[model samples]
Target: MFLALKEVGQSKIRYTLISLIMIAILFLVFFITGLANGLSFADSSSLQNLKTDYIVTNEEADGAVINSTLSEDQLKTIEEQLNQQSTPFSLTISAVEDKQGKEVNVAYFSVDTEKYSDIEIIEGKNISELTGNEVIINENIKNHGYELNDIIVDKISDTPMKIAGFSKNQTYTFLPVIYADFDLGMSNIYGDEPSYNAVLYTGEKVDISGFDTLTKNEAVKSIPGYTETQGSLMMMVVFLFIISAFVSTVFFFIITIQKLNQFGILKAVGADTKYIAKSIFIQVILLTTIGLSLSGLAIYGITQLLPGEMPFKISPTLMLGTAGLFLVLNLLGSLLSVYKVAKIDALEAIGRVE
Candidate 1:
């Protein structure tokens, strides 16, 4: 360990460059993972906030909440069969005009607020207090200059909906959501027969004949583009991690080769191969630790500077797990060099071979 530190101090520039490279690679991995998580959350925060065990959708809809259409009879049948309370809801994305007449895409959610009790109100009254023309919006809309008591016009019917309150972290498919009461007026707007997109229920198992039951996670995946987006970002993260390992292996291999003669001299003077290997291990550990720490800090600083609209979330647990994987891969990559050091012939490395 002492010798490894001495060498790193003597070769400050070279090690600094290597450390910088490691930092950059790890930063990209961390940032990409964070973005992937953020996108997933943004895509499904509305559903997640429901805190229900199962979402009942029409089987024909193929697990898509938006595409599912459940009639009053179907909802009642399921409720009767499962013997649990079910909240019928509808979700749609449409352009709505802000007070300034600027159109913005927002997800409109129609539900019986009294029955659906999982919503978290961050700054205003519960959804039950909202009238047909009154709505509760996600706080993210505040970024667009909308506030409590602001009037937003539904583009479809030109109905002015008042923002009665704000909810925290309720977004669907990356768009801010507005929760409105499923009154007779809103039901007429959707359809005359009173159909809902899906039903939210909490139960162990649902045996509805015509409807499909999905867990919360499954419902999230049913959102369009959610699965594909996450898959692509995760693939990139995996490839980057592989590349980092490869780079570390090559760099350490070259460093080990250059130090062959030094290892030979130490061995000739009474140092064992284990001692030499320990030094290499120490150097790899120090380098990886310093690089990952800096990368984490850099990610934190960058996220702080980003605009609120950008979907980027950093999970401490996920970051720590990623860092641990990176450290293990780096150490494994350096082992090739350690193997080389273990096989070093003192005489041959010192040019005493005849």
Candidate 2:
């Protein structure tokens, strides 16, 4: 163990270079991990914000928010059974026109003002005061140069919804979510009964035996391409993990091979294989630990510099999981060198036969 670390210290330049390479890979993996989480959150944040135990939507939409439509009668029956805060739901064409009248696509949420607890109004007035076509927009809307009291015009067949408030973290399908009163939103989107396609049920137990009750996650899956979107992002995360593992392993193996003469000398001096292997393992672990520690600090620094709307989130569990995976792969990589050390003949040192 002492010799391995000492050798690294002596060849500080090489070790530093290797650690930097590992650090770069770690940064990339962590970045991709953040992106995957961002994508997942964007798909489901609106449903999560509903603060409901269960989310019931159209099974036909296949987990898509825009595709599902449920009758108000279907909604009323569920509320009577589950004691829910039912809101008539429909998605409007998401066109947000900034102060300059330039447009960006977004997701519009039409919810109940009376049951506004299901959603929060961070800036400006609540739904109760919303009247005369007033509509509340998401924080993402505000970030795009629209501010309080800004007029929001939907570039569709329907009338424009007035922007009354700025909101927080309401996103779906990677688009920001804007909220409006059910009466106003439904009339604009559907124009009558069954106008609202899905129902957001807030309760402990939802009895959908007569009908189907889909949780928020299930509701999301009901949207076509929802799960596939998440699955693809996860595939990228897994790819980054593989890259991190293979790169670290190969580097360690090569370094060990280069140190063969030192291992042979130690073996001739009666060093135990167990002790030698342990040292190699210790060296690999130490190197990885230092690299991760630096990367952890770097991630924090980088996320701080990111724009608020960027889908970058920090999760300790994910960071720990990624680090642990690298640690195991690094140790596994040292196995080849450990085996090579074990086979070194002590007789080679003296050139003598027993």
Candidate 3:
């Protein structure tokens, strides 16, 4: 360790350049990770906030809540079979014009407010308090210049709905969500059919002959594009990890070759191979540690400077997991150089028997 530190100190510029390169690579990984997480949250935050354990959808829908359709009779049967209260829910993609007459895309969700009551109202009352054409919208609506008591008109039906309140962090399918009374939302979308897209329930698993029961995790995974988007980002992350490992291996190998004569002298003077290997390992670990630390700090700082509208989030568990993977892979890559050091012959390296 002492010798490694001394050597690094002597080659400050080279080590610094390597650390900078590593920092750049890791920063990209962390930043992209944040983006992946943010996109996922945007895709499913509305459902996650429901805090329900199970979602009942039509078996034919194949785990897709958006594709599921449940009639009042079907919902009642499921409720009775499970002996639990259930909330009938439906969603539609619609455009709403803000107070300034600017149109914005929104996912309109309708549910029995009394049964669900899952949304957290940031500034005003819940959707249950909404009387005729009133609705509760996500706080993101405020960014578009709509606020409490503001009227937003549905582009399709030309129906003007009053924003009775605002909730925080409610999004669906990567769009801001508007929560409205089931009757009003159903009337606008279904014209008084008294039907819903799915049912939300809490408790142990319940098996209905014609319906599929999905956990929260399974439900999230079923969202369209959720799997594909996350999968692509993860592949990119893995590639970057492999590239970093390759860079570290090649860099360390070259450094070791350059110092072969010094290693040979140390070995001739009674230093064992194990001692030299330890020094190399310590150097690799130290470099990786410093690079990871700086990259983590950079991610935090950069995210703080980003605009609120940017869908970027940081999960501690994910960040730590990624960092741990990088460390392990880098160590493995550094082992190649360590192996070369072990093969260094004292006499040959010193030109005494070459």
Off by over 4 Å in 3: 127-132, 186-190
Question: TM-score rank, highest first?
Answer: 1, 3, 2
Query: Candidate 2 residues 1-354, lDDT tens each?
Result: 687788788999998998898888888888888877877777777776765556665566655667666676766765666664665666765565677767788777776767656347688876667776787666777667877886667666346676787767688776777777765643354344436656666556565654556677677666557678778878987887777778877887787777766676787788878888988888888889988999989998999999887887759998999889878877887787788778867666445556
For 117-159, candidate 1 gives per-residue lDDT tens digits of 7478888778767656788889998877888888888777667
Best by TM-score: 1
**lDDT comparing candidate 1 with the true structure:** 0.86
On a 0 to 1 TM-score scale, where does candidate 1 land against the true structure?
0.96
Model 3 agreement with the true structure over 14-98: per-residue lDDT tens digits: 9999999999999998998889889888889987787578899999888888888887789788878888877877877888876
Off by over 4 Å in 1: 187-190
Query: All candidates: CA RMSD in angstroms?
Result: 1.6, 3.0, 1.9
CA displacement after TM-score superposition, residue 101 of candidate 1 (Å): 2.4
- What is the Cα-based TM-score of model 3? 0.93
Pick by TM-score: 2 or 3, better one: 3
